[model samples]
Target: MRTGIRQTDVLIVGAGPTGLALGIDLARHGVDALVVERGGTLTPGSRGKGLQPRTMEVYEDLGVLDEILAAGGPYPVGMIWQDGRQAGEHRMFDPAEDGEEGSRFTGPWMVPQWRNQEILRARLEQLGGSLSFGREVTGIEQDADGVTAHFATGEPVRARYAVAADGGRSAVRRALNIGMTGETVDPDPLLVADVRIAGLERTWWHVFPPAGEGAGFLALCPLAGTEDFQLVAQFPDGTDLEPLLTLDGVRKVVADRTHLAAEAVTEVGWSSNFRPRAALADRFREGRVFLAGDAAHVHSPAGGQGLNTSVQDAYNLGWKLGAVLGGRAPESLLDTYEEERRPNAAAMLGLSTAIHRDEARRGAKTRQLGLNYRESSLSEETRPAPGEIRAGDRMPDLTVDGVRLFDRLRGPEWAVVELEDGVFLVRPDGYVGWAGDSTEGLEGYRARVGA
Candidate 1:
């Protein structure tokens, strides 16, 4: 590794799913990207596991569907729960056919965040790319010509553009003096544990909400690599967890909530605390340094939209950045990244806050699949009324012909989809820029996209 200086067309900080997804997208266009990560290596934590249909489409296009499917778990049987008395149950989404256009992923995928990184790392190596770990970025200084980044250990790297995919504690954003607004919706602490729950052989995490002011809510979700369940419980608003966070205390909650026998108790592997955060940065880009994923936005793990949306954010921006780096489009095209992705991030933040307030969603959310962006520059040509705007709101998971689209088209690039009645242009980031009843010679469309 060169410590004095390094250079690449697009310098990406953080090799998490978002940064890695962006790297693959750039490589597909043959654009050179240098990825820097502050973490020593891939951290072994099964953080987020839900991959939405739109995100699957982006990943399939990037050529890593098989890996995801292999690593992820079985499709859940939706969710089953009621307010207090176990409200019956219902299927989350129709797995039979995905009706959405411009998207390839049908439902949600349950894979650990680390496993997602492992697959992306392998794919990066396959594409003749490399990553530098333990390269914590300390500051980012950008000029009219390019941007220079300084790390704690190395000299600096100059690039045409830089993206900050760093986690919630992003230094790039702070160094650039970016303002972020939003805070923890629940100031109280919740115990989050990832372990294989014994004696459970089926899908669907058994859940039990807290009883009253002194009780705690139980969140039992599935995980990858075993029959274990990810359990989360809310402690009293200001109660001290120092006494009741051990294996015995957590097991008592699980046993009481699910009514499982004592023999069903299993070993606790990993345990931690989580404070659901619902926040978004004031802006996604400042001069040459841009933000993505948690760096740009942070929200509760509700609706499983955080990771999926983050991946889509990178996918949407990657090609646009590559196009500019390769000189295919004017540098002004990069401005569209913030223009398009910021509003969508705000929407996710709002929805996630709602979910955190009340955790009841079982699986993939159909509403999340249908977010609309009529005000974006990417959709000026194919303007449609709110009634006419469907694909722009949500990418349907339906398959048109004999081929399955969702499994086939999730990669790190844009997918221009042609629906039965209209045509919708889907960016790799999983947002619909242009959608209308007809995509006839696309004269106006080409002029709008400037392609």
Candidate 2:
């Protein structure tokens, strides 16, 4: 490695929600990290528009939930249309019960992917983290000590640990020779575009089923906090629709699929086409390089789990990386990142695939609140008989001493919750690390985890 090369404690590739959220977590931990993006500006699109309840809690911990809620709104009811007339209403998400106790955020919040990234970037910058845009990682080299990321332009970055949050087509993951193995979730390619329409109402998510056999479905969802309506249309397998990303092409699709004319689409902001697929990397880590978000796992957008899962991936790795990099914990702690996240990502991938195939519904599973790490090596259940909430479960938000549980678990610290009967220790990422009738091994666990 060349002397005077740019250096940081952690090098995060990509500036999407995953990388930005991880950057925020590390920055708050006083870790020196740098985020590098291949593009000069943030990617533009309403790609992943739904934030699950678990992710809302993550945002709150990162100190950006207020901004996220202020910038987005609840998903509107789906309005079915037939013969150019109102047919009926369809609920896109499962209705939330009044005052759900386990979580404060009951339902998924609707926020465009671009807006979400912007908010995360803002929060990261506020924490004094640095992001280098237009810096593409062409290759990466790692050894026993650290990793070096070579760029297409500008100086290469040397960091104690490198994270590949650079999307599914991660250059660093590829350079490390990591293999992703999975099947295509769907054969039919889907076109998604953000556009401003003149005639569509923003009140409901407009849904148009297939007109006839071999036809496809079309959905125009009003993106909250913006004038753009996210247009999603399915096409036959092997359909060549790359040329349809143009403004005219989008307008033609909208006019042909619905009652609206081509002129109804006033402006097309961003568009892309993709076949829904679910894939997980063979391993989440290779030497000093760790893969996070889409770099490690890819999922269909059906259950809206891709972005949220990816963000949580970063959350899971952030604290571990911070601990090791800050010299507070042993390097062995980093291994748990792959241990805990890979299985969760695999499960979420199955859920997304199931939803895409219509074999499952977007209900409790899609909300991501039930996901746990009870099977993880770090989880310890010392109680004789645990209640509904056990070790490795997500710590439910409750008022203890008039302070919300989430309030105590907000920062990068282990929280010990004292309930009426037993005691529970919550990890920084909000999972119960230990549970027992008393604090029998709490000190040992705390010393081991560097809490």
Candidate 3:
């Protein structure tokens, strides 16, 4: 390493779920990567608390599923309150059927965003990955060779590739002059805080609907595996939000909306205010630098899609980067990162916006199990008669030769499985990349993928 410059195969900007998860994935593949964060520590608060099933699967592959399961629990039933009395029970998400075969997790899990990042960072470090805090990326420049990222306080970092996992107002994306197109899902700003309430039960998500005109709805959902409850209140449009971020202001809002008194709030840990919005970057790539997570797309929190989509963005990019940097795949293989992820991100943005507006419910669609890359240029389906599982679809967990399928697909390698005498090439990300009755096209596909 030079005096003021560091070198790595991949430079990941931002240490949120996206960047940390990408670091873990790349590390498991034996790739030398560095994750840099602008902040001094992992983010706090119960932001983006829900982990969808697809993301749970991704965690399993990244070797952190056990920690995630132990640190979080399932979403509780919603308890509706009226005039300080229990009005009725409301189900936040549509009831899902029993977990289907090959599906281990069918519902969303609730874990505070802070805890989730802790687990990801721990796993990344355990895998020999490197992360440095307080490394603020001021701007980044990329050429045909590599990317050079200049920070505010340290020597610049140079890498063969760079990714912006920064948030919606991504500084890296702006540095590349990428544009975001989006709309506000709601005019009213929402107040979300992590606080401890004296008498609130932890078994149910408490809901307080508006009692009269000019009043807003309030919901206090207990953050699983923690003592604090996440308070969410919708304010009238154009209302000033500066006061609501304080402890007294939160107590006042709780007292006014629900039956709770101002004295019931014991402690306030973190708070934030934001108007719900959904947006996507015009492009996911610029030269050797690419955008993932919030930098690539921003979603309303209604359907818990933001964080999950962001993690999946990292998962989708990780294997491709490993393949290219390791000299296993063609440089052009990197193009598929944007081609496969951008459209999916746009669709998720629409789904999140719809759910925020009550046009869609959190159920089958929000689970994200059915999301795939069937149309990607890398997806090759040469079978004369495709079965229930096709190329580009998520490879379901199954048992073969008394061994688990996902266990076989684990780690950083492509897998080939024979089902009904048909050959299936599973990508490292757990998607079926190619399917055929024989090895007719497997070698050609492998050559292209550097598998």
Q: Give the per-residue lDDT digits (tens) of candidate 3, residues 12-65.
A: 999999999999999988899999999999988989999998999999989999
Error of 1 at 253 (Å): 5.5
lDDT of 2 by residue, 296-331 (tens): 999999989999999999999999988887888889
Give the runs in model 3 whose Cα sits over 4 Å from its true position: 1-3
Tens digits of per-residue lDDT, candidate 1, 1-451, equal 3355787888989898998988888888788888888878975667777777767656777888888888886556535444534555545444524454435455677887878999998898789776889899877888888899988997688888899998788888888888899988887787877765676655665666565667776767777665667777787667666555567867776666655654465766667776788888989989988899989998787657788778878877887887677666677888888987898888778777876676544333433556555566666444355344344454555566776555434554456677665777665455565666677645566545544
Give each model a TM-score: 0.83, 0.98, 0.98
lDDT of 3 at 322: 91
Off by over 4 Å in 1: 1-3, 74-106, 240-266, 359-367, 382-450
Better of 1 and 3 by lDDT: 3
lDDT of each: 0.73, 0.92, 0.91
* True-structure lDDT of candidate 1: 0.73
lDDT of 2: 0.92
